[model samples]
Target: MKAMTYRGPYKLRVDSKPDPVIEHPNDAIVRVELAAICGSDLHLYHGMMPDTRIGHTFGHEFVGTVVEIGGSVQSLAVGDRVLVPFNIYCGSCFFCARGLYSNCHNVNPNATAIGGIYGYSHSTGGYDGGQAEFVRVPFADVGPTVIPDDITDEDALLLTDAFSTGYFGAQIADIEEGDTAVVFGAGPVGLAAARSCWLMGAGRVIVVDHLDYRLRKAEDFAYAETVNFGQVGDIVRDLKFLTDGLGADVAIDAVGAEADGHVLQHVTSAKLKLQGGSPVALNWAIDSVRKGGTVSVMGAYGPMFSAVKFGDAMNKGLTLRMNQAPVKRQWSRLFDHIRAGYVKPSDLITHRFPLDEIAEAYHVFSAKLDDIIKPVIVPAS
Candidate 1:
């Protein structure tokens, strides 16, 4: 098997590795057909996430065919096509029973902060990801759903993480009808959130980002208004002005540790590792929303301390909701939308590469080159 391995910061390689076998009773070995490189993966690629060991493959969003399954895996069998959510969990756990699968207590013994995530650091339970030709999926009955014949490969793959997380962001925002919602960042999650705001009955949606290409994507793909934070001078003030000086009814932070607006924050967090995460976008989200409005955070951040505006949020009576999205929880509504042709997850995909070119795919995505919003790895199993 050939897998993408991390050597150091800004470095990745495709190397031959031993094939994984079923290690748990409910485990299934899946031959990865379509795997996506998430923004969260970039945290590992740039050495942002701690304990991301060398040679650990980094990918979470994937759809594949089950080549083998353990005896306890009764929900699926060999030859079933499935989309595995990023979360690895036991369905009967305390949190899982409440539809909080992302915080399942039974998985990730090292997790006091988060649950098991495929291809993340030791902090999130170090499970090998689906970036390679094959991956081992534990708790097979709970983690993956059969991909319907109507769901295209790209749609199934996106639903595995990025798209689902974005929908989760919008779901928790609690947008009222005709409310103005503002989204920070124009990445896949941001774009999905912006689009979903409309579906959730938001009267207007605004996507904030510095990149012209991504802003263009937000306008075209999400059909939302765009604002280049770089040119706005004071982005928070501009957002208020756009919403008639009262501020937006809701604001979402989709940019996490690697936000680019503030040089000092970016250098301290993303470069120097002085802070767990840069709170530039989150702080901006707090300031851009109206007092007593909602602020939903879908961005991936480190477990360490971040200088967020907690005092201000309290003073303004803002509702701050954030968590690693319970991906499977959002699937039912999303599937209906997909079937109704209201949402197309496949549209997010922009580039595809073979397992042999995994390193180059990482470089292109990390560098934000070639207008690559979403890149999928097609590992030949």
Candidate 2:
């Protein structure tokens, strides 16, 4: 099997590897038809995430056909086309029973925080991801959902992570009817969150980003207003001004540790690795929302301590909600929205690459070249 292997920071290549076999009774081996390079994958590519070992394959969003299944995997069988959520978990665990699949206690040995995530660093669980011809899915009954015949592969691919997490961001916001919601970052997750805000009855939606291409996509895809943080002197002040001096009702931080804007913060956290992650976007979220508002964080961050604005959030009585999204939890509502033609997850896909060209794909996406928004990987049959 050929897969993208991480060698070091800014280094990746397609290398032949041993095929994965069913290691557990509940496991399933999937022949990956389509996979996606998520925005969060860049964290591993750039050495942002801790314990991302060499030879580790980095991909989480994928849809594939079940080539083989273990005896205990009764929910699916050979030839079943499925979309596997990023999280790997046991359905009967303490957290999983409460619909908190992302925090399942029975999966990762380092289970203090996040549960098992396919292809993320060792901190999240050192499981190989689906950025290859095949992948082994653990607890197959709980995570892999059969893709409906009507759904496109690209759409199902996005649902595995980006779309699901975005909708979860909006879901946690608790947006009231006629409220103004602002999402920071115009990546796929941010775009999805902005669009979902409208479905959640937000009167207005605004997307903030430094890139013109992404901001434009946010405007077109989400039907939301756009703001380039690079153009504004004080983004928080501008957001308050846009909301008529009171600030937005809800502010979301979709840009995590790698956020730009604050030079010192970005340098200390993202560059020097002094802190867990840059809290620029999160701080902006805290300062941009009105008093007694809500701030939802969907961005990926490390387990280390970050210099967050806890004092200001407490002073303003802001509700801060954040977690690795329970992807399967959002599928029922998201499937309905997709079927209703309210949102097309594939529309955000801007680039595609063959499995052989994954290194180039990573370069283009990491460099933000070709106006790339979302890039998909197609493994050879």
Local accuracy of candidate 2 as per-residue lDDT tens digits, 54-172: 99998999999999999888999899999999999899988899988999998999757779999997888899999999999999999999998888898999899999899999989
Off by over 4 Å in 2: 259-276, 303-306
TM-score of each: 0.96, 0.96
- Compared with the true structure, model 1 gives a TM-score of 0.96
Q: Record all residue pairs in model 2 with backbone atoms less than 3 Å apart, i.e. clashing.
A: none
Kindly list the per-residue Cα lDDT of model 1 for residues 262-345, writing each as its tens digit.
Answer: 232321223443454767788999998999999999988764366789999999999999999999988888989999998998
Q: After superposition, how far is residue 176 of candidate 2 from its true place, in Å?
A: 0.4
TM-score of 2: 0.96
Please list the Cα RMSD from the true structure of every candidate, rounded to 1 decimal place.
2.4, 2.4
Worst lDDT run of 10 residues, candidate 2, spans: 260-269
